[model samples]
Structure formats: structure tokens, C-alpha cells
Target chain A: MSELLKNTIRFILFILVQVFILFKMPPLHRFITPYLYYLFILWLPFSLSRAGLTVVGFIFGLSLDYFSKTPGLHAAACTLIAYVRPFVIGLLISQEGADKNYISPSIVSMGWAPYATYVIVLTFLHHTWLVLLEWMSFGSFLYFLGKVIASTAVSLLLVLLTELLFFRKQKFRTNTI
Target chain B: MRNVFLFIRRHFNFLFFLVLQIVSLSFLFRYNKFHEAAFMNVSTELTGRINEKYNGIEYYFQLKRTNESLVKENIRLRQLLKENYEAPDSNRRLVMDTIRVDSARSILKYNYLEAKVVGNTTALQFNYLTIHRGFAQQVRPNMGVVGPQGIVGTVVNVSENYATVMSLLHRQYKVVVKLKNGAERGAIEWDGLSPLFVTLKDIPKSAKVAKGDTVLTSQTSSLFPANIMVGTVYDIVPDNASNFYTLKVRPATNFFNIEYVYVIDNMQFEEQKRIEDSTRKKVQ
Candidate 1:
């Protein structure tokens, strides 16, 4: 299947699972709520423009908001993370990987540590902004601070678990004579 | 002017982010109220259909539990039937051979509309439930919904064939409840920490309250009928700042596993509201 088709399928599946399953997870902790749908944005091929990334993020988050009943909280968070994606990718990937034509961000392509950092940063950014906006007008700063940290940790774990289950190492072409 | 345009061209990404953020935040704030828009609710046609399809596959797994609750409710209802009790000897002397409608009849104030739980969420500070019944099924906003165990929520939005309920787990969701057979009244609100427990606020210090005592819906609320089981008091703490005790409640209905619910149609709700509104207007 084409990369476009594959990513499109991934997008739909993530939205479905996020809305129908993960959203309904019985709260294990008061502050922790798992959110792994942002994996679609994290896994996008590295070549997309910054503008494209932000737009996609908005649409993706809005789609979830449509069903989850939170109008724009997810969308704004996703857009912010998407806006910062390129810089994070540049910071993590080596020069050689940057020069490559199509690098799908994953454990195989970006190595485990860099990929993990990428997911962590993006997930943290997404959850922090999401919780802040969701609890807008609340007086308890410490409580929301705890919420941001706890939700980020839970989401990070979910992202890593998905990586373990689904991501396979891609064969990178070595430099030849 | 040239420098300004150059700066704008240089930082276009930031500009894009700002625009999108404004758009989304507008949506976030605009429809935050209860009945503003249908687009964000699960009651909308497309989302409702999708949720229904998903719930169809998930419903079977919950059949045993649902059946058990139904059977228990049936037994309870059967015991309340007039035929189950014999007339007293003193009353029997005054009783006529003709069947008395008022004496024999068990008046049912709230009619139940059985609905399948299609979509639900409990992880957020504000959570909602989407059920299969809606405007088409006479399920309207403010209708009380109860699971097999206890009170669930009130319907907040309705489409042609689906309704969205402001779940008991939501931070903004509140229900008036009182201790069973006790005069102490309080309101139940989720603490947003655990799904298992909600905090019951406003019970006065003088009111008798104890652990494991049953909490029930108060008659003051128009949404739920009086005396429906809400939960049992798990713990009670006296608030130093106020003259009330905050009782920790273990909700009777397991919100996470809710599969089916019955929406209540209060027959006298409209008349009751009309009278109440008129009274309020006169006072104002």
C-alpha cells in the first residue's frame, strides 16, 4: 500500500480506538487518562511542511472533539505540538537521516531513544495544553499541575506500548562504494 | 512597512498557529453551555450511528450482568404488586366486593424508556454518555437515566434518534440526594479523581449520617424520581469552614461497565415546571 493510504488507515483506526475505547477507560488514577491518538502525527513522514503539519493536527484533534464533546481543546493542543514538530525532529535525527528522502518517524528509522524523546515531548505538550484548556477558569494551580504531569506519564506509556506492539524496524540503506 | 511584511513572511508558522488556536478556542468556549449546539454532541447523526455500531458489538459481552440486574428489578417490582399483600382483618370488614381502582392500583409516576448505551467516557473532568434513544423515542433533555444499580445521569442533548447524557462522573454534574429514611439532604459531585467515589456536599452537622448508610435521590429534583438509590456513604468528613459534612459516596452504578439504562419520562414534569416558573416570576 502507498504511504498515504497506510497513514490514512492509521488515522482512522486511531480516531476510532481513541473515541470508542481509550476515552471510556475506567480511571485508574484521578489524574491519569491515556491518550495515544497523537501517534498518527508522530508517525507522519518527515517531509511534510510545517503548515501542513499544523493543519493536519487541527483536523485530527477536531475530529476527536466532534465525538468526545470537547470542541477545540484537543485541536488547539495538537496544533501547538504540530507547530513544534519540525524543530524536535531536527534536534533528534542525525544529518544523514535528515538528508534521506522519506523517513517515517519510528523506532526503526529514528532509533529507540530519539523516537521515544519525540513521542514524550509531543505527548507532554499535547496533554499539558489539553488539561490546561479543559480546566480553564479553575483556581487550583497545583491540582492542574499534577494533572498535566500524570496524564503525560500515562500517555507516554501508552505511546511506548503501541510502539512495541506495532512498530517494526525498517531496513535502512547503508552507504556503499 | 517592508520590514513588517518581511517579518510576517519569516514567521508564518507562528501566524498559522495563532489563527488555528483562535478558531479552536472559539469552539471550545462557544458551545460549552448545555444546549447551544448539536454538532459537538454524540446525538448528531453520523457520530451517533458510528457509536451505535460500535456498541452493538460490545453489548453482547455485558449481557450476563444486564440480565442479572433486570431479574433483580423484576423481583422488586413483583413484590410491590397489590396482590402480594393481603388485606388486614379490620379493613376486610369495610371492603366491598367490587375492585377499587385507587386501592388496588400501584401508581407509576415515571415511565422508563429502555435504551442501549452506545458511547461513554469517564476519564475526563467532564464526561458524557450517549444512548440509542433520543427525540424520536421521546427522550428529551432533563430526562433522568438510571442504570440497573442506581441513578446514572440526566439527558442533556437529543437528536432524532440519539441522546447525550451529562454523566454523574462529570465535574459539573450534580444531583440532590439524601440519606435513606433520614432528613439530611446534600448534593453529589464527582471529585474527578476516582470513578468509584463522589463527594456528597451540604449535609448539616446536626443531620445523622454514618458509613454504609444508603444515599437516595431527593424529592426536590424534577429530573429523578424520589427515593431512587444513588449510592452508599463510604466516609464522612466535617468541613471546618462550613456547618456541613462532606460524605464520600461509593456510587451504586458502576459507571465504567454501564451497558443499558432506562430513561425516565416524568408525566407531571411539564406541569410542575410551569407552576414553579410562574412562582419564580411572581417572586421576581
Candidate 2:
């Protein structure tokens, strides 16, 4: 499948899974909500432009917001992460070595350590922005920190599990969109 | 002009990112204000329909619990039926009737419209529930909603066939409540820490309070009828600086498992509001 078709399918699947399954899951804890939909933005092909990335992130988050009844909380967070994803990736992976070759991020392409760092940093940023926006207050700073940490941990775990489960053995095929 | 065009070309991606961020933040502040604009919400037709379709599948799993709650509510209402009680004596009843008739004539102050919960969230700071009833079912904004056990929330937004309720778990949501025993009125608000408890504030130190005391909606509230169950006092939060005592309350309705609710429409709300507004206008 073309990279564009793959991402299109992934977008619809992520929204459906996030809204219909993950959101509907019984609240395991007050502080823990697993957000795996943002993984779509994280896994987009590396060739996409930064502006294109932000637009896709906005729509992705807004689609979830539309279903979850939170108007812009996710949209703001997702856009921030999408805009920052390139910088984080740039910091971890040099332009000449792997950037020219890698089609998209995966556990195999980026290796275990760099991929883990990439997911951790971006997920933490997304969760912090989302939790901060949802909170919109500094009254309960401790509670806010607790929620951010807890949610980020859960989401990071889910992201890693998804990478391991689906993309563990796949080779970096140069399929341009 | 040439330099400006070059500048735009150089930073177009950053400019686009900033614009998108600003739009999202504006939406965050604007619609997150709750009652200001209700268009970008789950109550809209498309989102509501999708939620309803999903809830249709989830409803089956909740059928047994929903049935039990409905049966319990049925028993409670049945017990309140006039036929359940017998009149004492003809002479005493005749005297009592004259005294009670005036108050009873105005008893039809609130009407209820039943609705099913299609979407609800208790984990978020600003939690909301989407119900299946809306303007089509006479469910309007500012109407109080109640579950079978106790108070749920107030309707904040409505569409043609769906409405969104600002859940009691929300940080900004508040309701005036009084101790069932002392009748000292106070406001109940969530601290955004827990879904199981809300904080009751402004009850004077002079008022007698206990951990197990029941809290009920006060007469002063325009949204909810008096005597609706708000919660039960769970703990007393001590404050040395203030004369008022803050009580932690366990809400009677289980927000985590709410399936069905009744949207309460105050029949005289508009008339009462108009009169109050006129009085304020005259005073001013």
C-alpha cells in the first residue's frame, strides 16, 4: 500500500479505537488515561513537510475532540507534539545517516534506545500540554503533576506495546507517498 | 516588499504552526467557557448520532444494572403514591384539606423528561455527559438533571435531538445545598481531585454537622427543585483561618455508572426569572 493510503487507514482506525474502545474503557484510575491516537502523528512518513504535519495533527486531535466533547484540548496538544516531533527526531537522529534512508519511525529503523527516547519525550510533551490545558488552573499543582505523569506513563507504555506488536519485524521499505 | 516576501518564505512553516496553535487555543478558551458557545460539542447531530450508535452496543452490557435501578426507582415512586397512605379521620382531614389546598395547588412546579446517557466522562477535569434528549424532547439549557438515586447535573447545551450536561464532577460546576438536619445552606463544588467526592463550602461553624448527614438541594437554587438529594457528608475539612466548615460529600448518584437520567424542567422558571429581573430593574 502507498504510504498515503496506509496513513489514511491508520487515521480512521486510531480515531475509532481511541473513541470507541480506549475512551469507553472503565476508568482504571483517576489519573491514568491511555492516549494512543497521537501515535498516528508520531508514525507519519518522515518526508511530510512540517506545515503539513501540523495540519494533520490539528485534524487528528480535533476529530478526537469532536467525539470526546473536549473542543480543543487534544487539538492544541497534538499540534504542539506534531510540530515538535521533527525537532525531537532531528535531535536524536542526524540528517545524513538515517534521515535520508528511513521512511518512517519504527523500533527497527531507529533502534531500541533512540525510538524509546523519541516516543517518551513526545508523549510526555503531549500529555503535559493536554493535562495543563484541561486543568487551566494552578490551584492543585500536585494533582496536576500527578495526572500528567500517570497519564504519560500509561500512554508511553501503550505506544511501545503498539510498536512492538505491529512494527517489530517490518523492514524500512522506501514507499513514497 | 521584497524582504517581507523573503521573510514570509523563510518562516512560513513556523507561521503556519503558530496560526494553528492560536486557533486551537482560541477554541479552547472560547468553547471551554461552557455556556458561551455550545456548537462545537458532542450534542451536535453528527457526533450525537455516532455516540448513540456506539451506546446502542454498550447498552446491552448495562441492561441488568439499569433494570435494577429502574425497579428501585419504581418502588420509591410507588411508595409516594397518594393511595399508599390512608386518611386519618373525616373531621380532621376536612380541616387539614383547607390548610393544605393552597400549597398543593402550586405543587406542579417541576416537570421531568427522561433521557438515556449516550456519552459520559468522570475522569476529566471538565467532565460532561451527552444525553439522548434535547430541544426535541423539551430538554433546554439550565434545566436540572437527576439520576434515579440523586442529582446528576445541569443541562448546559442542547441541539435538536441531544443535549450536553455539565457533570457534577466538573471543577466549575456548583450547586446550592443544605444539610438535611440543620437546613444550613451551602454550595457544593468538586475539587477536581476525585470523582467520588465533592466539597461543600460556606456552612457556618454554628451549624451542626456530622459525617453521615444528608445534603439536599436548597430552596434558593433556580436550577434544581428543593429537597433533591445532593450527597451525604463524608468528612469535615478543618480550617483554622475561616469560621466556615468545609465538608466532603459523597454524591448519592454514582457518576461512574449513570445510564438514565431525568431532565427537570422548572415550569415557572421563566416567569420567576422575569419577575426577579423586573424587581432588580426597578431597584436600580
Candidate 3:
């Protein structure tokens, strides 16, 4: 499948899973809301420009927000992470290396450790922005901290699980976008 | 003009990011405020329809529990029938009235519309529930919603086919309630902690309070009817410096498993509010 088609399918699947399954799941803990939908933004092909990435992120997040009835809460967070994803990836991977290979950031292409760090940093940023916006105030800093940490941890685990389960042995495409 | 164009070209990505961020943040703040915009919520046609469809599948799993609750409610209603009660003196004749009015039968105060819970959340600091009833069904913003067992929340936003309820578990949600025994009224608020409990504050130290004491909605509230079940006092939080005692209350409604609710409309709410506003303005 073309990369565009693949990512589009992934986007729809993510929104459906996040809204129908994850949002509807009975609360496991007060603090642990697993947000795996942003993984679509994280999995976009490397050739996409920064502006394009941000727009995609905004749309992806807005789609989730539409279903979950959170309005722009996810959109803001997703935009933040999308804008920062490139910087985080650059810090971890060399420019020439990223350009030459790696259709997208994944455990197979970026190796396990770097891919894990990429997911962790971006997920933490996303969750922090989301939780803080949802809260709209810092009445209890500890409670806020707990929510961000717990939710980020759960979301990271889900992202990693998706990585290992589906993209465990995928080969990087050599063709350009 | 050339310099400005150059600057825009140089920082197009950042500017785009900033513009999108500002738009998103504006939406977050604007709609997140208490009942400003309703189009972005789940009550909108597309999302509401999707949720209703999904609720259809999820409804089957809760059938047994829902039926039991319905049966329990029926029994409670049946027990309240006038036939079950007899006058102390058999000489007095009993009167029956289908309309819910005072002895004069002049006015009706409260009306209830039943709604199915299409979506709900208890884990978030600001939680809301989407119900299948909306403006088309006479459900409107500011109406009080109550579950089978107890008070749920108030309707905040409504579309044509659905309405969104601001759950009592939400941090911004508050209502006036009083101790059933003492009649000392205080505000009930959720502390962004557990959905099972809320905090009752500002009750004077003079009033007698104890664990397991029942709390009910007070006459001060315009949204809910008086004597509606709010919760039971669970524990007292010690605050020696203040003259008021804070009590933790376990809400009567089990928010986690709520499936159905009643939207309560106060017929005189607008009139009462208008008069109150005019009185305040006149005083000012």
C-alpha cells in the first residue's frame, strides 16, 4: 500500500479505537487514561514537511476531540507534540541517516532504545498539555503530576505494544514520498 | 512590506504552528467555559448519532443490571401509592388527583423527562455525560438531572437530538445541599478526586453531624427540587482553625454504572431568576 493510504487507514483506526474502545473502557484507575491515537502522528513518513506534520497532527487530534467531545484539548496537545517531534527525532537521529532511510520512526528503523525515547518524550509532552488543559488550573500540583505521569506511562506502554505487535519485522521502504 | 513578506516566508512553519495553536487554545478556552458554545460537544448530530449507535451494542451487556434497577425503582414507586396508606381516621374521605399540584391546583412546579445515557466519564477532573434526549425532547441547559438512586448533575449544553450533562463529579459542578437531620445547608463540590465522593463545605460547627447522616438537596437550589437525595456523609475532615466543619460525602448515584437518568425542568426557573435579577439590580 502507498504510505499515504497506510497512514490514512491508521488514522481512522486510531480514532475508532480511542473513541469506541479506550474512551469507553471502565476507568482502571483515576489517573491512567491510555491515549494511543497520537501514534498516528508519530508514525507519519519522515519525508513530510514540518508544516504538513503540524496540520496532520491538528486534524488527527481534532478528529479524536470530535468523538470524545473534548473540543480543542487534544488538538492543542497534538500540535505541540507534532511541532516538537521533528526536533526530538533530530536530536536522536542524524540528518543524513533519517533522510536516506526510515520511512517512519519505529522500533525496527530507529532501533528499540531511540524509538522508545522518541515515544516517551513526545507522549509525556502530549499528556502533560492535555491534562493541564483539561484541568485548566493547578489547584493541586501533586494530583496534576500524578495524572500526567500515570497517563503518559500507560500511553507509552500501549504505543510500544502496538510497535512490537505489528511493526516487529517490517522493512523500511526505500522509495521517497 | 517586503521585509514582512520575507519574515513570513522565513518563519512560515513556526507561524503556522502558532496560528494553529492559538486557534486550538481559543477553542479550548472559549468552549471550556461554562456553556458558551454547544456545537463542538458530543451532542452535535454526527457524534451523537455515533454514540447512540455504539450505546446500542453496549446496552446489551448492562441489560440485567438495568432491569434490576428498573424493577427496584418500580417497587419504590409502587410503595408510594396512595392506596398503600390509610388515613388515621377512617371517617375522612380520600381524594385523588392526577395532576401534580397543590391543594388549590393552580400551578405545576417541576417536570421530568427521561433520557438514556449515551456517553459518560468519571475519571476526568472535568467530566460530562451525553444523554439521548435534547431540545427536541424539551431538555434544555440548566435543567437538573437525577439518576434512579440520587442526584446526577445538571444539563449544560443541548443540541436538537442530544444534551450534555456536567456530571457532579466535575470540579466546576456545585449544588446547595443540607443535612437531612440538622437542615444546615452547605455547598457540595467535587475535589477532583474520587467519583464516589464529594466534599460538603461551609456547614457551621454548631450543627450536629455524623458519619452516615443523610444529605439532601436544599430549598435554596433553583435547579433541583428540595429533598432530592444528594449523598450520605462519609467522614469529617478536621479543620480546627475554622468554625465550619467539612464533610466527605458518598454520592447516592453510582456514576460508574449509571445507564438512565431523569432531566428535571423547573417551570418557574426563568421567572424566579428574572425577578431575582431585577431585585438585585434595583437594590444596586
The candidate scoring highest on TM-score is: 3
TM-score of 2: 0.92
How would you encode candidate 2's per-residue C-alpha lDDT over B1-284 as one tens digit per residue?
99999999999988888898888888878776745433554336677888788889888988898899889999999999777788776865633356676777586788888999998877667788999998878988999999999999999888889998999988789999899997999999998777889999999999999889999998789788899889899999989899999899999998867899999999899999999999999999
Off by over 4 Å in 3: A94-97, A175-177, B41-43, B88-106
State the fraction of real interface contacts model 1 keeps: 0.83
**Number of clashes in model 3?**
0
| Stretches > 4 Å off in candidate 2 | A26-29, A94-97, A174-177, B34-43, B88-90, B94-107, B281-284
Runs of candidate 1 with Cα error greater than 4 angstroms are A96-100, A168-177, B1-11, B35-38, B41-43, B91-109
Kindly report the interface RMSD of candidate 3, rounded to 1 decimal: 2.0
Q: A40-67, model 3: which lDDT tens digit per residue?
A: 8888888899999999999888877766
RMSD per candidate (Å) reads: 3.4, 2.8, 2.4
lDDT of 1 by residue, B1-284 (tens): 99999999999889988999999888888767644443554426578899889888888887888788889889988999867877667843554456555664445568889998888888787788889887878998899999988999988888888888889988778888888856578899987878888999988888888899999998888788888999999998756888989889999998877888999998888889999999999999
Number of clashes in model 1? 0
How do all models score by TM-score?
A: 0.89, 0.92, 0.93
A70: Cα error in model 1, Å: 1.8
Q: Please tell me what DockQ candidate 2 reaches.
A: 0.58
